[model samples]
Target chain A: MIRITTPLTDDVIKSLKAGDSVLLTGYVYTARDAAHKRLVELIKAGKELPFDIKGQIIYYVGPTPAKEGQPIGSAGPTTSYRMDPYTPALLDKGLKGMIGKGKRSGEVIESIKKNCAVYFAAIGGAAALTAKCVKESTLIAYEDLGAEAIRRLYVEDLPLVVVIDSEGNNYYEIGQREYLSSLK
Target chain B: MREIHVNEIINAVRDLCIEANYYLNEDIKNAFLKSRDEESFKLAKDIMDILIKNAEIAKNENMPMCQDTGMTVVFLEVGQDVHIVGGNLNDAINEGVRRGYIEGYLRKSVVKDPIDRENTKDNTPAVIWTNIIPGDKLKITVVPKGFGSENMSQIKMLKPADGVEGVKDFVLKVVKEAGPNPCPPIIVGVGIGGTFELSAYLAKKALLRPIDKRNENPFYAKLEEELLNLINGLGIGPQGFGGRTTALAVNIETFATHIAGLPVAVNISCHATRHAEKVL
Candidate 1:
């Protein structure tokens, strides 16, 4: 069981490989479909984003509302490919990691190779257990979007599977192909 | 004739919404469980373990099964003998969805318009389908459809001549095209016949059934069996990692349709497959 700290560097990021399970600890952020659109828009305009892009990891999640005595609600990875278009830009800005489910695209794969970034996926829909990883969370921007808001979360040992590595390998696509061909 | 107050209906919808989001239907849960034992690939089995753990955590922790929380989709059956008092039946259902999403801490996933895309704050204005029946009880099925699985769902308009072989081809095509996108090891809900819309409805409805169970119609049941065999044969195991278990089950729901066309809708569900129903 390998555990690593969050907001990882390009060197730390490059060391990881596809299919390795890592428990992510330290600062993490959440974003989903809506935020992706806005982030992309900002990237297109060459404007600054709310948080520093350097060595940051964005969790692809929009958790349920917190109940009594809870820090955050059920939190899990949303599909990753939805943000594929914006990923290369983020990677270029020193973003080292992303957490989501499913496969990524060619451009994003190339970006990972160039930028030494990696992608991880928490079990999709395992929201509550996911919330346990978030030790501290606060809204940094876009609060009006409700769950879609950009928030900084301090996490401790958040579990994830390395789906895409800095070397430009993606588990989802490769795994699916291997699985499909094996049957026939 | 039974006259039900509007408040009662709203309350029923509200309760149903919470129940649906919090709990995974027994059948869907069973499907994931069964897959754990049967999956041949080591990685697929491990992924299944994560899914099962996710479900247990969601339930015991009183969390929404997925963070997407899904767009609210309710298939409502209203009896002809029942007359709603005070307000519109549709209003009651929407309000119930709003209340449930807000009160239950479920995420608000509905968008007002597709192009403009404004958030509906509370997963309101559920995608509701109503059918009038000859009874007093009103059935509300709350289906929270996550984006991943919903995106992978399909509608097939095959020629009437193609028949079951066509369905087999179409279903496999969909699964193949979907790849890892639907979260894999999906439950395939196939609806045959009816019009385009009705067939799609049947497909969504088919997903509510138990995973391994066959359709009551023996002919369709055989299709389910054959399709199940074919889908698993694809080797798109859990999380689309290599495995013997591609689909947990293939459920087929057929309806009477136009003579010239054969429409099939595939409502693909990820391992999460969250749905719950309440008849009141």
Candidate 2:
């Protein structure tokens, strides 16, 4: 497995490939359907974003509320496709990486390739295990959105797979084909 | 007739909600272990291990297995001989959901309006289905359905000419299109032979069955096994990273249909498929 930190650069992204397992450390921003809509709206309106989009990863999740003495509740990636309509805009703004599950639109894949960004897939439904990697979580914007609110999280050794790399190699296609052919 | 108080229903629903979210059912856990051992791909096996461990953590910590605590779906089998007193039945069920989501620290995922899109905050107004039964008992089953899987579900209306092959094709198409989205290895609940709405309901209800249990009818049970094998052959694997375990099971429930119609609904559920039951 490859070990990588946040603020992914062109060189780091280029080195990664589809089907590579990754251990992601450092900070990632939490955003889901509501937060993505707002972020895109701000960009479209020529307004300042809640946080800098450069050199950052966005995890599509709306986590359960943290219990007493817990940093966060069961935290894991939500489906990524729901954010597809707004992803290209974020990618254009120098967003370095995305962490979520599921396929992305062709448009988003093109943007990922053009912007030299990568898409990571954390194990979907592995929320309790995922939460253990979260060191800290601080709300950044859109507090009224509740679980959909943007939170900056410090994650350590969070396991992820490179589902789509900067060159636009997609693991979903390649992995499935390889497995199916192996059986034949 | 036996008298049943609304308070009992409320409290039972509340407890069931918490229990369902916090505890991963034994059937699912065993399925994961069995799949993990049988999975051919190393990464797929590892993914299964993570799922198994996640369930363990959720149970031990008394936290939800997944963050999407889901919209509460309550199935009520109310006895025809019982009289419910003291409050409205729907209100009691909603109250149970409200308390469970709030007190259990679960996420409130319901919105007041689908179009207007405002959070209900307390996860009220659960999607409830009630059926009248013969006994004096009431059976409450709470299935907190995560939208990650729910969104991937589909329904199709085929002509009677489409037959079984048509049903198989439609199910495969849905699973293929769903890809990695619904968090495979998914459990496929298929409802066939009913009208449009009834088919959809039966599909969802099929999910409530234990993964290990086959359909009671010999024909449908065989069809279930066949579809399951075909799905596993798709190579979606765990999380769609590709392997032999795309689907853990395929459950089909059928009902009488009109002569000209064959409506099918495929309700895809993630491996974290959760539900709890209580009888009062």
Candidate 3:
């Protein structure tokens, strides 16, 4: 497993390939469907984002509440496709990495290839195991948004897989097709 | 009939909201473990390992299993004799949802509209269904609906003559079309019979059953077994990255329907099928 401590850089993104297992540790941000919408709007209005995206990984998650002394609640990757629209724009701005499950669409794949970025999928439904990697947690912004609020997390060896690499390869699709073909 | 205050119901619902999100019920946990034993693909098995690990971490640390904390879907069985002392029964349920999602640290995924989509700050106005059964105790089932599997769900109104073969084709088609998107190894919940709406409900409810268990009807039980074999044969495996456990299980729930129609609904649930219920 490749261990990466964030803020993710071009080197980190370039190093990953589809199918490579990853353990991302360090500070990263969380966003889901609602926040993704807000982010695109921010890009459209040409306003400053709350955090620097350049070479940073944004995890598609809105976890359960953290109790006293806990770093973060069950933080796992959500489906990545929902953020596809905002991805190209963010990639253009030097964003290099994402963490979530599921496959990317044609447009997102194209953008990923063009911009040279990687998409990692966290294990779906394995919130408990994933939470063990979180070392610390803090609210970055959007507190009123509740779980949708953008929270920063300090993680250690958080497990993931490169679902979409910089070269436009998507393991989820390939994996599925391969399995389907084998059936015949 | 036994009587309980409305506030008690609200508190029960509120607690269920947090409990349902914070923990993975034992039935789901055991299903995955059993699937691991039965899974054929290395990649699929590994992915399932990740899922099992994720669940363990979530439970230990109080983290939600999935980020799509889900739209609040509550199923209520209210006793006819019970009296609600709270402001309103519906309001109590909504209030509980609001507090549970907010305080529990789960996402509020409800949107105001599907089209000109605007989020309703709190995940409120739950999709609640109440059945007035002859009982004094309130029974509530909470399903935190995730979009990955929910998006793949389908309903078909087939001609009665189309029969079992037609159902098989459609079920396979849904899984085939869904491929890796629904986050395999998947669970296909088949609600056969009933009307269009009830079929859909049965499909979702069917998912609550243990992943390794079979339908009670011997005929349908055989169908479930066959369907499981067919789905797993797809090799969509765990998280669609390939493996033998394309689908961990196939659950079928049926009800008597009109003579003219055979409504079949498939509610596909990902490996992380999270659901819980509490009776008070």
Candidate 4:
């Protein structure tokens, strides 16, 4: 498994390949459908984003409210395709990685290749286990959106698998094909 | 006639919501363990292990098993012989949902309107489905449905000529298109026959059945096994990592339909297919 940190560099992105297991560390920005819409609207309006986008990973999650003494609730990746409409714009602005589950649109894949970004899949529904990786979480913006609000999370050794890499090699395709062929 | 108070229903619904979210049901946990033992691929095995461990953490820590504690779905089987006193039934259920989400620290995922898209804040107004039965008891089942898998569900209207093969084809198409999105190791709830709307309802209801149980009808039970094998064959293993355990079970529920129509609905549920019940 590859050990990587957020605020990723071009070399780190390029070195990864589809199907590689990764343990991601450092901070990741949380945003879902509502937050993404607002963020994209800001980008279009030439307004500054809530946080800097360069070299950052965006986790598509809207976690449950944390208990009194916990960092966060059962935090797991939401579906990624829902954010497909706004992904390219973020990629264009130097978003280095995305952590979520499921497939991305062709347009998003093209942008990932163009911007040299990566897409990682967290084990979806493995929320309780995943929350253990989150050391801290602070609401960054859009509190009215509740769970859909944007929060910045400090994750330590968060487990992930590269689904789509900088070169646009997609593990969703490669892994399935390999497994099916082995059965034959 | 038996007299049932609204507060009884309210309290039952409240506890059901929290209980359903925090504890992973034994049948599902066993399915995970069985799948893990049977999964050939390393990654798929690892995922099953994580899911198993996640459930343990959620239970032991008293936390939600998944963040998308889901939009609350309450199914009520009200007895015809019972009289409901105190307040309105729907209001009581919604009140229960509100209290459970707030008190349990569960995520409130409901929006007031679909298009306007404003969070309801308290997760009020649960999608409540009620049926009148012959007994004096009320059965409440709460299912907190996460949109990740719920969004992947689909329904189709087929001609009577389409037959069983047609049903199989549609199920495969929906599952394939859903791919990794619904979080594989999914539970496929298939509703065949009935009108367009009833078919969808049956599909959702089918998910309430435990994974270990098969359809009561031998023929339908056989079809369930066949579909389970075919889905696993698709190589969309756990989280679509590719293996033999894409789905833990394929449950089919059917109702008599009109002469000209055959409506089929597929409700794809994630590995955390959560539901809890209390018969009061």
Candidate 5:
């Protein structure tokens, strides 16, 4: 598995390919449907975003509340499609990586290629296991959104698979098709 | 008539929510182990191992197995001959959900309004279904339903003439279209017959059954086996990475319906299929 650190650069993203397993470390931010909508709205209104999007990764997750002495609760990826409408805008802002599960839209894939970004998927239901990889968590913005609030996480060796690369290759299609053909 | 205090119901539901979220059911755990053994795809086997390990950590550490601790669904069977003293029924259930979520550190996922979209803060107003039964005991089964799989669930109203073939085709189509989105290695709950709404209800209810069990009807049981095979053939293995165990189980539950309409619903559940039951 390839190990990639956060605050990803174009060189780092362009080197990856779809279907490559990855261990992501460094800083990643959390956002789901609610926070994405607000972020897009801020961009439209010419208001400053809560955090910088340039050279950063946003995980589509709404984690359970952390227990006392724990950094975060069972934190894992949510489905990515719900954030599709707002993704291209964020990608345009120099966002370099996304972490979530499921397929992205054709439009989002095009934006990924155009902006030299990558998409990675953490195991969807492996929340407890994923939480073990998170080293620290801090709430960033949109506190009223509760679980949907933006939280910054410092992670170490969080297991992920490159689902879509900057070159526009897609793993969901490639992985399933190849595996099915091999069986035949 | 036996007097069962509302607090008993409240406490039971509270414990059910906490227990269900923290502990992966034994049937599901065994199903994963069996799938791991039978799985030919190396990647799928690895994914299964991660899930099995996740369950162990959750139980041992008292953490939610998945981050989406889900909206609480209470399938309540209240005894007709018993008296519920001190409080109303629905409030007690919501109170239980509130306490359970707060105490257990489960995520409060429910929003107050669909359009306005504000978090209710305490995951109250659970999706409750109550039935009056003959006995003097209250049976509550709490299923913590995460929306990742719930969003992929589908329902169809087929013409009566379509028959079994139509049902079979629709079921396959839903699972196929869902592909990886519902997190494959899913539990498919099929509800056939009844009205459109009732069909959906039966589909969710079917998920409560253990994966190893099948419909009592021999014909339905055969259909379940057949569907399971076809789903596995789709190559949408664990986490949609591809493998032999696309689905852990296909559970079907049926009720009589209108002569003109054959309603069917498929409720897809992720591998973290969690539910706990208690009798008070």
Candidate 6:
């Protein structure tokens, strides 16, 4: 597995390819459908965003409330496609990576290529295991959104697979097709 | 006549929500263990192993098995002889959901309105289904349904001419299209017959059944076996990496329908199919 950190540089994203396994560390910002919509609205309105988007990775997640002395609870990626509408705009702003489960739309994939970004898949239904990777988390924006609020997270060696890379190659398509064909 | 206090219902549901989210149903855990052993694809087996380990961590640590603790779905089999007291039945259930979500620290996923889109914050107003039965006992089953697989579920309104083949083909199509989205391996819940809405309800209810149990109807039992085999053959595998275990089971529930329409609803639940039940 390749080791990478957040605030990914364009060169680092370009070096990755579909199907490469990654262990992502450092930091990522958490947001989901509601937060993404609001972020896009802020951009359109020419207001300053809550954080710097340059070379940052946004994880599509809405974590549960943390118990006493815990940074976060059951932090895992949500479905990615729900954020598809606002993704191209985020990519245009230099967002280099996205961590979530499931497929991205054709338009979003095109943005990944044009913007030198990558989409990573964290294993779905493995939240407890994934939570082990999150060493620290704090609410950063839209706290009224509750779980949907944007949070900054510090991660260590979080397991992931490159689903779609800067070149626009998709592992979900190629991997499943090859595996299904092999069975025949 | 028997009576149940609303407070009791609230407390029971509160505890049910917590228990269901933390504990992987024994049958589902066993299924994962069995699939891990049976899978041929190394990646698929690896995913299964992770799921098994995740369940253990959730149980031991008192954490939700998945981050999407899910909207609570309460299925109530209330005895006709029992009267609920102290408050409105629905409100009491919602109160239970409120306390459960807050106390358990589960994610509050409910939106106030689909378009307006504000967090309800308490995860109240569970999707409750009530059935009147013949005993003095009330049975409450709480299933916390994560939406990743829920969004992938489908419903079909088939003409009488479509028949069984149509149902089978449509199911396969849904599974094929869902491919990687539902976080396979998944449990396939098929609701056959009934009107449009009832069919969907039956399909959702079918998911609550134990994976090892087969339908009493011989024909449907055979169909379940056939569909399970066909789904696994598709090689969607665990987490859609491809293997011999695309689905853990196919469960079908049927009800009488009108002459003109045959509705089939398929509700898919992912590996974290967390459900708990209690009788009061």
Candidate with best lDDT = 2
Deviation from truth (RMSD, Å), model 6: 1.3
Candidate 2 per-residue lDDT, tens place, B47-108, comes to 99999999999999889999998999999999999999999999999999999999999999
Clashing pairs in 6: B184-B239
Q: Which DockQ-derived CAPRI band holds candidate 6?
A: medium
Worst ten in a row by lDDT for model 3 chain B? B57-66
Task: Give the distance in Å from residue B212's predicted Cα in candidate 2 to where it truly belongs.
Answer: 0.8
Runs in model 2 deviating more than 4 A are none
Model number with the top DockQ: 2
Q: How are the candidates ranked when ordered by lDDT, highest leading?
A: 2, 4, 5, 6, 1, 3
lDDT by residue (A1-184, candidate 5, tens digit) is 7998978877888899898888999999999998999999999999989998899999999999998899999998999999999999999988889999998999999999999999998998899999999999999999988889999999999999898999999988887887789887
Tens-place lDDT per residue, model 5, B166-257, is 99999999998888887778999999999999999999999999999999999999999999999988888888887878899999999999
Model 2 score (lDDT): 0.94
- Give the whole-model CA lDDT for all candidates, comma-separated: 0.82, 0.94, 0.80, 0.93, 0.92, 0.90
DockQ list for all candidates: 0.64, 0.91, 0.54, 0.89, 0.83, 0.74
The deviation in Å at residue B37 for candidate 3 is: 3.1
Quote each prediction's TM-score: 0.95, 0.99, 0.88, 0.99, 0.99, 0.97
Indicate the docking level reached by candidate 4. high
Q: Please report the TM-score between candidate 2 and the true structure.
A: 0.99
Score chain A of model 5 by TM-score against the reference chain A.
0.99
Compute the lDDT of residue A150 as modeled in candidate 1: 89
The sequence of per-residue lDDT tens digits that candidate 3 reaches over residues B1-280 is: 5767777777777788878776777766786787787766566777777777777766765667776678878888888876666478889899889888877877767878889666786789798988898867788888888777888889999999999999999999999877766777777899999998999999988987877678878999999999988887776777777777778789999999998999999999877676778888
Question: In candidate 4, which residue pairs clash?
Answer: none
For model 6 the local lDDT of residue A23 reads 94
DockQ category of candidate 5: high
Clashing pairs in 1: A74-A127, A75-A127
